[model samples]
Target: MDVHGTVAPGFEAVRDVFAGIVAHARGGAAFSVVRRGETVVELWGGLADPDAGTPWERNTLCVLFSGTKGVVAAVVAALDVLDPEAPVRAYWPEFTAEATVGQVLSHTAGLPFVDAEHDLLDTAVCAAMLARQSPLWTPGSRVAYHPLTYGYLVAELLRRTTGRGAGALVREVLARPHDLDLHLGTPPELDARVARLVRAPDYRISTFLDDPERRRIVERMYAGLLDSDELVNSARYRRAELAAASATGTALSMATLYDLLAAGHVAQQAALARASRTWSEGVDALNDRPLRFGLGFELADPIGTYGPAEVAFGHSGAGGGRHGAWPQAQLGFSFVTNELRAEDTDTRAATLLATLYDAL
Candidate 1:
C-alpha cells in the first residue's frame, strides 16, 4: 500500500505502524495524531470504494458512529451552559423530572432505548416519545449505554438552551474556529466524499456472547434499536441528525478537534476534566463487560479498547473508529476506517495506539 502523508521528525515509527495496518485493512482507513496542538502525523491508504476501486483520498470522509459522542460532549462542555447536577427537566421540560444532566452524560439515565416506531428524525415526535416513557431503572442507580437516544436528549437540551440545532452549535463552537472538517450531518455537496463501509464477513453479535444469560441480557437491552448494517449505511441515515452516531469526517478533522480540546482554555479544560472523571465503572448491564465511563467519554480500562492509560478519554464507534486524548501525554489521536467489524474484543485500533505511545 502506498501511504500518502507526512510525519514530523522522530515520528517515522508511527507512520510505519499506520502503513502496516492500512496494508492489511480490507477497506480504506486514516490515522492521525496531534501532540501539544501540533500535527505530528497524518496518513491514509487503501481503497475507499473497494467495489469501484476508488482511492482513499485525503478528503475521504467516514462515519464515526458512537465516536460522535465525544464531539457532542465537547460541544456541551465548552458551552458550559448546563449545571451537571441540575435536573434535565429544568432545561428541557419534556424530559423526566428526576433525571439529571450528569446522569444523562454518564449513561446512568434510564432512557436508553426508544420505541422501534419512533421517528428519529422528527425531533418533536421523538422528544414526546421519550417524555412519555418511564425510566427502566431508578435514575442514576446503574449504568446502561444509551446507543441512540443519548444524542437526542443532549441535542434537545441544546435546542432549548441555545436556540440552535446541535450541529450548528458544534460547528460554530468547535469546527469553525479550529478549521476542522467534521460534521454532524453531511451536506449534499460533500456527500461524494463519503467512503463506502464494508462489513466484516464473520461479524455478528454472537461473537461477543460468553453464555446464554449474557446473550439474553444483551438482546433485551438492545431491543427496539436498529441493529441492521443496511440501515446504518443508508443515505437517509447519513443525512439525519443522529447525534450519538452518524458523525462523518476525515481522521485529521477528528484528531484536530481532540487536540484543540486537549489544549483548550482553562474553563474548557476544567469542564473536560470533570466530564472525564470516573462517573461509572464496573460490568455494564447492556454490554456485559467491565466498562468504564466518565461524563460522556469512555475512560481507558485494563481490558478497554483505547489502551490502558487511565487518563485517556474518548468514545469508540460501533465498528472501527476511535478518537481520544491523553492529557498526561498531551496527545490527541483518531483512527477511522470504512471496514466495519465487531467492536467487542477488536484490538486492531488498540495495537496502533500502543505503538504510537511507544514511539513517543
Candidate 2:
C-alpha cells in the first residue's frame, strides 16, 4: 500500500523515497519520509502478519520502547519553554536526586534504569523511588541511555508542578497548540485510527522466559514497571497515563510536532538550545547497546545503520515504526508500519537513512 503524498511540485524526492520503500518491502520492511513540514513519502509494502494476510498499513502503531522517551522529554521540555528558571524540582519535589535540571536534560542524571525488581505500572510510587534513588555515577559524569527511567522522571516532575498528568499536559499544552495528533495515552476517539501491532518474528522468545539469568536481568530492568503494553491496550490503561512507553500515534504527527519544537516555533528555542549539545558525540561501542544518544534526543548511529549524518533529532521504534523532525531543513519526517521483521536491525534503519539523505 502506497501512503505516498507530495506537498510540493517536485517529484524526484518522492520517487527516491518510493524506491527505498520498494527496497525495504522486497527485503521485508517498510519506509517513509517527510520534507519541509510536509510528508513526501508514506510508502508501505510488506506483510504485517506471518501468513501475509494483513498488508502493512500507514497507520500502524507499535511499542516505541525507549524511543518514546524522546517524546516524553519533549513534553517535559515544555516547562523550560515556558519558564526556564523554574527549578525542575519545583515541578517534581521528589527530584532531589543529586542532579540538576540541566543534568537530567543532558541525560547525565545517573538514573539509568528503574529498580528493575518492581512493577512499573505504578507511576507515582516508582517516581518517588527515583527521587531518592542512588546515583549510578556522579551526576553529569558521563552519558548513558536512561532508557526506562527518563520518561518516568520527567513525567513525575511535570506532574508535580503542572498538577496535570504528563499525557494530558502534553495534549493540552503541546499537541493542541501545534494541532498535532501525537498522544501519550490512546484516547477512545482515536481507537479507529490505531493500526494493530504486528509482532515481529523474534519478538517473543520462549528462551527468555525459561532462562533464569536473562529473566533476572529483565526483572531488574522494570522491577516496579507495570506490564504497560498489556494495560495500554485495555480501556483502563488508555485512560491511565503511562507516559514512559504507552504513547500511541502516527509517524506523521510525531515528525511534525518535533519539527515545530526543534524549529523553536511554539515555545522559545533558547531554552532547548543549551541542551542541544550532542550528548553522545560518538558511539559508545563498548557499552553493549549500539544506540547513539543526544540531550533528551537521539541520532541514528553510523554503526547502528539508521538515520542521517544530518539527523536533526528523531526516535525510532523496533520493526520500522520511526519518526524524525529535521530542524536544519524545516522538514518533518514520519513512518509507521504493522509489518514487523527481525532482519531490519540498526543497520537497515541506516539504509533507510541513506535513501533519505540522498533525496535531500
Candidate 3:
C-alpha cells in the first residue's frame, strides 16, 4: 500500500509500522501523533471506499465507534460543569436511579440496558425510559460497561446542564476553539468525506453467544444496533446525535483534541487528571473482559500497551480506532480505521503505539 503523510525527524519507524498494517488491512486507516504540542507523525493510506475507489485523504473521517466516549468525555471534562458528586437527579429532575455524576461517567452506575420500547433516535423518550428504570446493581458498587446507554445518560446530563446536546457542546467548546474536525453529527457537506465501513470478515453474533448470561446482556445492549449495517450507514444515523459511538473525524483531529486537552485550560487538565484516575478495574462481568475505566476514559492496563505511560488515557472503538494521550509525556496519538476487527486479535494500534514511543 502507498501510505501518504509525513513523519518528523527520527519518527520514520511509525510510518513504517502504519504502512505494514495498511498493507495487510482491507480498508484504509490514519494515524497521527503530537508531542509537546507539535505534530510528529501524520500518515494515511489505502482505499477509503474500496468499491468506489476513494483514496483515504488526510481529512477522511470514519466512525470513532466507542472512541466517541473519549471525545464526549473531553468535552464534559472541559466544560467542568457537572458536579461529580451530585446525584444525576440534581440536574435531570426525572432521573430515578441513585447514580452520582461521577458514577455515571465512570460506568459504575448499573443502568446498562434500558427495558423500554422506544426509537433509538428519540432522545426524549429513550432518556425518560432510562430515567425511570432502576439500576441493575447498586450504583458505584461494581463496574458494568453501559455501551450504548452511557452516551444517552451523559447526553441527558449535558442537555440538562448546558441546554445542548453532546454534539453541539462538542462543536462549540472543543471543535471550534481547537479547530479540530471532530464531530458527533456529520454535517451534510462532509458526508462525501465520510468513509464507508467495511464490515468485519469474521464478525458473527454467535461468537458472543457462548455464555447464556453474556448472551442476554450483550443482546440487550447491542442486538439491533450492532447487526444492522443499513441503520449504521444511513444518513439519519450520521446526522442524529448518538454521542456514545457516533463521533467521526480523522486521526489528526482526534490526536489534536487529546493534545490540546492535555495542555489547555486549567479546569480541563484538572478534570482530565481526575477522570483518568483508576475508577474500576478487573473482569467486567457484562463485557466479560478484564477492562478498566477511569471516569469516561479507558486507562492503560498493567501491561501498558495502551501507552508506555501508566497515565495514558483515551478510548478505543469497537473495531480498530485508538485515541489517547500520555499525559506525563505530553504526547497524544490516534489510529483510526474503517475496517472492523475483533479487539482481541487486533494489533494495529498497539504496534503503531509501540513504534511511536520507541521513535520518541
Which candidate has the highest TM-score of all? 3
Mind giving the per-residue lDDT tens digits that candidate 2 earns over 69-160? 66766765656632433555655665666676656655667776665445566677777788878877877676655545666777766666
Alpha-carbon lDDT, every model: 0.79, 0.57, 0.83
Cα lDDT for residue 341, candidate 3: 80
Which candidate model has the greater lDDT, 1 or 3?
A: 3
CA deviation > 4 Å runs, candidate 1: 205-229, 265-267
Q: Candidate 3 lDDT, tens digit per residue, 175-252?
A: 888788988888999999998887777754423236787778777876377675677777788887887888899899
Give the range of the ten consecutive residues with the poorest summed lDDT in model 2.
200-209
On the 0 to 100 scale, the lDDT of residue 169 in model 1 is 77
Which parts of model 3 have CA positions greater than 4 angstroms off?
Answer: 204-210, 303-305
Q: Sort the candidates on lDDT, descending order.
A: 3, 1, 2
Provide the lDDT at 251 for model 1: 91
Find the 10 residues in a row with the least total lDDT in model 1: 217-226
Pairs with backbone N, CA or C atoms under 3 Å apart (clashes), candidate 3: none
Number of the predicted model whose lDDT against the real structure is largest? 3
